[model samples]
Target: EPEVTQTPSHQVTQMGQEVILRCVPISNHLYFYWYRQILGQKVEFLVSFYNNEISEKSEIFDDQFSVERPDGSNFTLKIRSTKLEDSAMYFCASSERGVGELFFGEGSRLTVL
Candidate 1:
């Protein structure tokens, strides 16, 4: 089965910079999501995208963050103006529909200094 995959397994960046994480979700899935976990914290939802628009988003997703499909095969998350508190493991996930199981990628770890 096709599963979600993420790139640049780890990213180390300086404060005030920008970072873009990439993901490829299962081709047949209809929902895509971005979630994050700060070092010892629980996973938090950032945003959900479906039908080319944002379906839902959490408070953690602020003006500094944006999500885009860009093209049919790729989904990306951009974080502008990095802050030290933004360091976390960002996960890319997808589901056949928004209600049930969600398949998650290994994640892209972001380290801000």
Candidate 2:
């Protein structure tokens, strides 16, 4: 079955650098999400998109972060300036109806030094 795929499986960057994580969500799915887990912490919701627009976002998704669907299948998450605290595993996910079971990518690991 087709699944969400992310690039640069792992990345190491200096603080204040920019990072753009990419993903190709399931073609038939209608909703997309960007979630992150800070090392040992629980997964946190960053943003959700549907119908080509963000449906909702969490407080953690401040001006430093943004999400986009650059094409029919490509979805992306950009961190304007990486911080040491931003180091974590970022996951891209999709669901057929924006709820219920979600298909998740293996995740892009970010390391900010």
Q: Tell me the TM-score of each prediction against the true structure.
A: 0.97, 0.97
Among the numbered candidates, top lDDT falls to: 1
Window of ten residues with lowest summed lDDT in model 2: 1-10
lDDT of 1 by residue, 1-113 (tens): 68899988999999999999999999998899999999888999999999999999999999999999999989999999999999999999999888799999999999999
* TM match of model 2 to true structure: 0.97
lDDT of 2 by residue, 1-113 (tens): 88889987999999999999999999899999999998888999999999989999999999999888988989999999999999999999999998799999999999999
TM-score (C-alpha, index-matched) for candidate 1? 0.97
lDDT of each: 0.95, 0.94
